[model samples]
Target: MSRIGKKPVELPKGVSASISGQTIEVKGPKGTRSFTAGDDVTITLEGTTVKVTPRGLSKRARQQWGMTRSMVSNLVVGVTEGFKKDLEIQGVGYRAAMAGNVLKLSLGYSHEVNFEVPKGVTVSSPKQTEIVVEGIDQQLVGQVAANIREWKRPEPYKGKGIRYKDEYIFRKEGKKK
Candidate 1:
């Protein structure tokens, strides 16, 4: 038995879910999201609770069942309450700014990099070094943040680069001669 699958997701107020065939759609105040059910996964709605169960106890099937359930639950909640990701730019002359639908980042590079913000997502910089990404889709928000951070990964020696707000980079000292 899967611990996560055993637990049913409680539907919050103002959020609604609809299941059709192998697709589940969730709509809320923020926006709407959808997820495709796996082959062996079964999704059911019992009153205000959503349940996911697998056809068999196979390793992969069981794993997918739990993950699908969690993803569906997250979709419902994310569309209702939304999701956010914070990133920090570290180093001299490293900063970020929003211009129209694009985000311009200066990560100690010779040329500035412009990232086009996707629809339904908002990128804001409270400070030159801090960036906040918000959207109803958790996966998209995370992917966008990761792509932006990839432009300038943290260097081990100086520990300077773009990184998530909660990410920690352990630094190592140079070898002594």
Candidate 2:
């Protein structure tokens, strides 16, 4: 049995959930989100909580049981609290700014790099070296942050580039004289 799957997801005071076949929809103050489970699992709404169970005693069913439960839990959290990702720009002259729907980045490049923000997610630059990504969908928020960091990943030698707020770069030794 799956430990996480055994626990039902509780709906907060202002949050609500509904089930339609294999799909589950959750709505809260932040926004609304939906998730459809695979055929190996069954989803049910019990009072103010949601539950997921496997269809049979098979490996795939057991795998889907835990995964489906986690997905449903994410939906509830997404609709209620949403998700956020923060990135820090390092190195001299490295900075970021938000211009309407575009994120302008200056990472030692000859020309400034313009990144267009996608829909449903909000990107903000509270400081020249800080970037914040906020959205209801966790995956989207993380992907956007990753894409921005891809422009200039932190190098091991100089550790000059963009990186997550809590990330650590493994510094390497320089050439010997």
lDDT of each prediction vs. the true structure?
Answer: 0.90, 0.94
* Predicted model with the maximum lDDT: 2
lDDT of 2 at 133: 98
Candidate 2 collision pairs: none
Worst 10 contiguous positions by lDDT, candidate 1: 72-81
Q: After superposition, how far is residue 97 of candidate 2 from its true place, in Å?
A: 0.2
TM-score of each: 0.94, 0.98
- Give the alpha carbon lDDT tens digit for every residue of 1-177 in model 1: 888888899889988889998898888899889999888889998888889999887898889987988998899879888899999999988999999899999987789999999987899999999999999998889998899899999999888999999999999998899
Clashes of each: 0, 0
Model 1 spans > 4 angstroms off = 175-177
Best by TM-score: 2
> Model 2, poorest ten-residue lDDT window?
73-82
TM-score, structure 1 vs. true: 0.94
